[model samples]
Each structure stands twice: as C-alpha cells, then as structure tokens.
Target: MGVDGVFVAEPVSNVLGGLACLLTMYVTVYRRLGR
Candidate 1:
C-alpha cells in the first residue's frame, strides 16, 4: 500500500510541478515578447 501510494503521489506531484513551471515560463516569455 505504501509503495503504491508513493508511486501515485510522485507522478502527480511531478506533473503538477512541471506544469506550474511551464506556465510561469510561458507567461514570462509572453509578457517579454508582448512588450
């Protein structure tokens, strides 16, 4: 159960973190280019 929990949690956390990072980067670049 613990192993399964870790497996599920790790991917979910990584995906969220990656998306957040990508969104921030995209916004920053878009603003810079817009200006």
Candidate 2:
C-alpha cells in the first residue's frame, strides 16, 4: 500500500513574514559592511 500525505497549518503567517524580512535586512547589512 502507498502512504498518504499529511497537511499542516500555520496561524502565525505574519510573524514568519516579519522574521524573513529581518533576516533579509541583516544579510544586506552584512554584505554592505563586508564590501
């Protein structure tokens, strides 16, 4: 028999998005400083 896939939910979508933005900002700053 084949296995079935499962579904997951994330209620903190905005929080995750904010975290991503912060990470991106940090990377940008690091690159600018490294140059």
Candidate 3:
C-alpha cells in the first residue's frame, strides 16, 4: 500500500510541477508580448 501510494503520488507531483513550469513560461511570454 505504501509503495502504491508513492507511485501514485509521484506522478501527481510530477504533473503539478510540469504545469507550474508551463504556467510560468506562459506568463513570462505573455508579459513580454504585452510590453
């Protein structure tokens, strides 16, 4: 159970991290374009 939980949690955290990185890049581009 613990190992299964770790596997599930790892993907979720990775996805969240990926989304955060994409969001940061999008905002940076938007700001640059806005300027």
Pick the TM-score winner.
3
Model 2, 1-35: lDDT tens digits are: 22322222243566788899999999999999999
- For each candidate, C-alpha RMSD in Å? 1.3, 6.2, 1.0
lDDT of 3 by residue, 10-32 (tens): 99999999999999999999999
Winner on TM-score between 1 and 3 is: 3
Lowest-sum lDDT 10-residue window in model 2: 1-10
The whole-model lDDT of each prediction reads 0.98, 0.73, 0.98
List runs of model 2 lying over 4 Å from the truth.
1-11
> For model 3, where is the 10-residue window of minimal lDDT?
1-10
The Cα error of candidate 2 at residue 19, in Å, is 0.3
Candidate 1, residues 4-35, lDDT tens digits: the string is: 99999999999999999999999999999999
For each candidate in turn, the TM-score is 0.82, 0.63, 0.90
Candidate 1 weakest lDDT stretch, 10 residues = 1-10
lDDT of 3 at 33: 100
Greater-TM-score candidate between 1 and 2:
1
